[model samples]
Target: MKKLYILGIMSVVCVFFGSCNDEWKEELHSQMISFKAPVGSNGVCDIYMRYQPDGTASYELPVIVSGTRDNGRNINVKIGVDNDTLYHLNTEKFAVGRKDLWYRQLPENFYTFPSEVCQIPAGENVQNYTLNFNLKGLDLNEKWVLPLNVEEDPSYVRNIRKGWCKALLGINLYNDYSGTYSTTLMNIYVDGTTNDPAIVDNRVTRVVDNNSIFFYAGSVWEEDENRSKYKVIVTFNEGELNKDGNMAGSLTIKQGDPTSGANIVPVGDCTYELIVQKHETKPYLERHITILRLEYKYTDFTSDPKNPIIYDVKGSMTMERQINTLIPDQDQAIQW
Candidate 1:
């Protein structure tokens, strides 16, 4: 009786090992093709691109094959622009009925796909779809999106999982002086008085061109529907380095819409200084610091169009951008 019990246990072990043998030999999950783009709460993947003048910048979007085992055959994944998806996404995201706030589709003139089809050879699990961008005249005021989709093919299985087959790429172009500036030292006061001041900690400046950027004037920000009226465009003109190893420059400040916008006037000579320093401990780290000395005045019409108030903004603003020399990619090198 004991011998029979031992025989029965051996038989059960053999069956269990035999069943798992076939499982490990082949993939149990479906080999579905999908995109590697990850979206945020806004349903868009924010990608940073370094501004390239008179040239094209390239971004590689990864196409992945899902499964435990290697891909058995080659895949020619057809890619196309899906504007309809972007239109529906905008409507779903922003139901506030504000068209200006909606994301705009990137025009064809700004971007081009090297190949409409991405080829993944046998035994490869991933490949990149290259998108070349010529963002020379790209407007930064409007939010831009590049929507891509993987077309369904009879040759391979497509990943039907949510957000796997589609990618919403939000393009953010950055230049040398276009970024967030620390505005704690900057003070805003009513046109006549300078005692009590209103200070904003941080102010974001948008890129206008290779050497120009625009920011909201004084305490005015994006919350107001007519915030565009207070737009202050600043163009940097860099000069030779001074004795202190600092490059001095002057800024040309202008109203975005001179005719129909807030009456903006410069109080003094608006100038800037740039300083570059290397990290003491980390030799691979480099820091670029920009200091802006500004004194400007602008009329605020959005607070109450009927009763507009004039504000006097003065003092210095600073921005520091750190670059890692170890990274090969320009976009990834910035600590932003």
Candidate 2:
């Protein structure tokens, strides 16, 4: 009985083996012989590569992949570069935990691949694949520098000096001699030059208003021993006063010698006044006056020829009441 039982078991095992072999052969004949990744998967996802006897090959590449996985499902990935001269390959080794994958294309000197395969669980959605590569054309690493300088122009300097003089000391000096007055005085000098003791008393009149003011004044210019220092003065006088005791007028004093074409130096400390009055019978009248004074001591004028003689001038004016107004102060005043 034991021998029969053993024989029966052997017979059953042989039939089972025979049936399995036949089924396997039939399935292989019908099914394609290749390795393939499931539809819609990427990274280390399974891919099928088939090589036929006719020297033809087929590959099923994944469409999408992830860098990481939540479950134990992870994919292994590898890359290779083949060129005429060289062949390089690398593999991804570690499992990615997140989905965000960054692949940058760098200058291609060699090929590299992920050392590990990416994996996704069954029934998982497929992901898109990202491919990156770089090509080398030229080298880049250069720098440049520039040198610059800034300075004031000489023409600008001269113009600035002239503008400053015009803004500060260039003014008209005037005096009226129609009233009972005599000897109106004026002075001129360089704006910043110091004065010497020898030429202090030089004074002259520059203008004479013979019409309304009826005054005569003349100007005098004298250079010091060194010819670098100069003194100029102007004076005016009124011949007589009118019957109404309201006899006055004005004059204008300007730089530059009328006879010698010499430019008068600008006086720094100068004051000017304007007076206005209304006559009962005549129209309103206005007057302007200027005065300049200087105090100088000897100094080396040869140091800079551009430097000129300096002086201070003071100017004032008095207007008579011609309108017969009640307020005396309001009737006649300086405009200036």
Counted clashes in each candidate structure: 0, 51
Best candidate (score: lDDT): 1
Candidate 2, after superposition: displacement of residue 10 in Å?
99
User: What shift in Å separates residue 326 of candidate 2 from its native position after superposition?
Assistant: 37
lDDT (Cα atoms) of all candidates against the true structure: 0.87, 0.27
Check candidate 1 and list the clashing pairs.
Answer: none
Candidate 1 residue lDDT tens string, 1-336: 999999999999999999999779988899998898899887898888876676468898999999999998989999988878888888887757677778899999999888889999999999988999998877677789999988999988889699699989998888888889999999999999969899999888887778888888998765556767778898898677888989997898888887854889888799999999998898999999999999999998767789989999999999999999999887889997
User: lDDT tens digits, residues 1-336, model 2?
Assistant: 999999999999999999997775442321111112221222222221111222222221232222133222332222222121111111242234311121112233311222222233333424222222121221111101111011122211111221110111011122332222222333323345335212223332321222222111122222222221222332333323445443332232333223422344333432223234454353444332222232222222333557633334333322232332343542123222
- Using all chains and alpha carbons, the TM-scores for the candidates as numbered come to 0.90, 0.18
